[model samples]
Target: MMENVVIRTVSRLAVPFIQIFALYVIVHGASGAGGGFQGGVVFAASFILMIIAFGTANVRRRIDNRGIMWLSVIGITIYAGIGFLALLMAGNFLEYAAIEAVLGIPHLHGILIDLVEAGIGIAVMAAMVSIIYDISGNGEESS
Candidate 1:
């Protein structure tokens, strides 16, 4: 638990940039070489960096166990909800075209894809962080 000023300051400065880049990857998923998995892994890497620099205890204090569970649930729900919405619209699962027609949006398909990517990112990030926390004995469920 030794605190080094230089290390701490550098980590503090770098974390925000890491997060921003992760978001950039998620948003630019449609344009080029980026998507939910890459962005999510990058986001999780930021937390991993925090765990290394600060400690698992600090990371857990920031996000907590219940928060992770809710994040996972919300993410998958958003994903499935979109699929179900398509079904309700009388289309097969994940048929974004149906969503576009029903909602009458010109570019709704791409936007919905982006939304799904975001959900996947959130879920992956939570899962990765939870896995790290558990492996390091920081998870609440750990005895």
Candidate 2:
């Protein structure tokens, strides 16, 4: 999927909208039955599309490897941070009740979980897309 996006420049135009929609899905996962993992994959698809349309060099110009790496790290850190916070408050990792108390929204456990999952998804997707872009040699030669 990433490869196809990178090779097709047309996808670039649609990437932004796709990413936004993915975020919406992630945020509303609790109500709509979607989650972070799904949204993250969708978000990553945007970068893959950019890479497909533009090539590594072009993509790199837009977003350097270092930046992508940092983003990946930050994403994972956010996931872990949330889990750690939950553990501190609830005595269990990723326990949303603890988070709810902290945030003063004790009734939105599902929504909170969805937000966390979305963070995870974004991170995973970005990392995966970066990896794919790094490995893919270049856009396929035009016929």
Candidate 3:
């Protein structure tokens, strides 16, 4: 845990901006230079900052092991669900054209891409955080 008041304060202040930028990267991935992996790493970095400043015990209270596992599962489920839905629609796996036909909207492909990206970002973020906890040797309660 961080002991320096100035460091802690600065990390607290910077975390929000870091998160916002990560979101921007995730969202902008559909249109420009950014993607799920980059955004997810950035997002996880914010929590990592918190871990460094506040310690695992404090952060774990806010987000436990179960919570992290669920988030990762949910994210991958979303991604796979979309693909399966497309397949059920008689299209090849992950074929956005199938979704576009059903939705009948402009740029449906882009929308689907964005959704998948979001899912990937969520999964990666949770997984990375979980890894950090494990490496820190504080993921489990000392019973």
Please list the C-alpha lDDT of all candidates, in the order they appear: 0.89, 0.74, 0.90
Predicted structure 3: lDDT:
0.90
**TM-score of every model?**
0.93, 0.76, 0.92
lDDT of 1 by residue, 69-88 (tens): 89999989988999999999
Model 2 RMSD in Å is 5.7
Model 2 over residues 1-115: C-alpha lDDT tens digits?
4467444656756887998988887887777777778888888777777766765677777767677777778878878887898898864898887778877865767765765
lDDT of 3 at 62: 95
Q: Count residue pairs with overlapping backbones in model 2.
A: 9
Q: How many clashes (backbone atoms < 3 Å, residues ≥3 apart in a chain or on different chains) does model 3 have? A: 0
lDDT of 3 by residue, 69-120 (tens): 9999999998999999899888999999998898789788888899999999
Descending-lDDT candidate ranking: 3, 1, 2
